[model samples]
Target: MLYFVYTADRPGSSALREELVEAHWAYMDGFEFHARGPTLSDDGETATGSLHIVDLPSDGAARAFVTEEPNWRAGVYAAMQIFRFEDLVGRTMWEFPGPEGERFLVTGAAGEPVGDGVIVHGRLRGLDDGAVHGFAACVQAPDADAAARTVRDGRDLTVRPWCFGGRR
Candidate 1:
């Protein structure tokens, strides 16, 4: 079974999050079923949440995975959702092709029709800012037109992919 673990950071808890970053990674590294995941964002620089898509042997395993996370244990997370997902598409962010130094900010809505083709064309795999989903990705195309062409359909939400410092 594939599980989508959405976690939101607690307000004013940046200090606690910083303190637990290493421990959080360490805990995630210990997971046996983790697959694709990413830190959620809003502006791209500051992290606001996280998304973990993992394959587990059973519901019990999924439950255990969350209970053992460092942020949950330390109270740095304010909200989260565990969804049993289906028909998941899209590759992991780590697999997205781009220069090693290339990084950009992405903000948009959750794909449409939940179970339908939500997994359309896009390399982003996380959410930023609680209001709208945001993420950082290695844009496959140099421009939006080229990126849109890669999707199953040529239509998609605008992926204002901007470099870290600011728009070029």
Candidate 2:
């Protein structure tokens, strides 16, 4: 299954994150990752989070991937999201083929992460509006619980799961 993992830096953790970028990339390269990248805003220089797509056998494997990741091992993330996506567009953020990145439409209930689903839409890879209280990316996971666990480890999180077109 394809799992989309979204990682958000903890408060005041950007410096630590910058320090681990190279190592993070190098580590991801060693795995069976489709494409792991940072989430850039409209300006495209400010990295808000990270998006990673990986093929795994089960949620346990996905959990292992997160636990063994360089950045996560180095404490670079404050939260993350794993989605059981279907590749509605069947494309990657790098394959969107536009000078401008994607624009996503993430829909969900309030206080539970409304933009998590938007990351799946290629055009809106990391784009968000005011309602998008937070940011997230999408992927296809073995199941909904596994997708949710990709971000939560018995901790509080504002994650939401929705159908394909639901991703704005």
Candidate 3:
């Protein structure tokens, strides 16, 4: 099963995050990730959160992945949201064909399921039977408004600046 892991950094935790970067990458190397990145501030430099879509065996495995991450273990995250996910675009962020411009993470209650112009697209799954209940996407757009419009056919959405993840 695929899991969506969204982790928000605690205020003043950048130093801690930097300190654990190597251990974090080493831990992540053990998993199969579909899409992974750091959520950025409006200026596009500071990392405010971490986003990852990973394939794991069960909800328990997903929880373990998040809780065991170096950042989480080191108290770099103020909050973490985990959900079962379905890959609608069926591709990784590395497979994105569009030009690398500004990117945003657009997510909300599932509406009409738009996949056009998305680098990564997926739906949040229900806890009981794995039915899709919400939608999410990482998209390249000129601005947050445009990114939201791309996926917001009629649902409430939250748009956050984002970028592709990994070493510099």
Compare the candidates by TM-score and give the number of the best one: 3
List, residue by residue over 82-136, the lDDT tens digit for candidate 2: 6543344555544534343233223232212222322343221221221223333
Put down candidate 1 lDDT per residue, 85-163, tens digits, no spaces: 4423455444434444323222233332222212222223322222323222224344454443333332234444333
For model 2, the stretches where C-alpha displacement exceeds 4 angstroms are: 32-35, 40-45, 100-168
Model 1: number of clashes? Answer: 3
* Candidate with maximal lDDT: 3
lDDT of candidates 1 onward, in order: 0.49, 0.50, 0.85
Ranking by lDDT: 3, 2, 1
Model 3 lDDT at residue 135: 85
Clashing residue pairs in candidate 1, if any? 41-128, 41-129, 128-134
Clashes of each: 3, 11, 0
Report model 1's TM-score to 2 decimal places.
0.56
lDDT, model 1, position 37: 38
Question: What's the distance in Å from true for residue 81, model 2?
Answer: 1.9
Query: Clash pairs of candidate 3?
Result: none
List ranges where model 1 is wrong by over 4 Å.
32-41, 98-168
Measured with C-alpha atoms, the lDDT of residue 36 in candidate 2 is 59
Stronger candidate by lDDT (2 vs 3): 3
lDDT string for model 3 (59-158, tens) is: 9899999998989989999998888988878888888888779989988985543545688888898656887778878988889888887864648788
Q: Considering summed lDDT, which 10 consecutive residues are worst modelled in model 3? A: 109-118
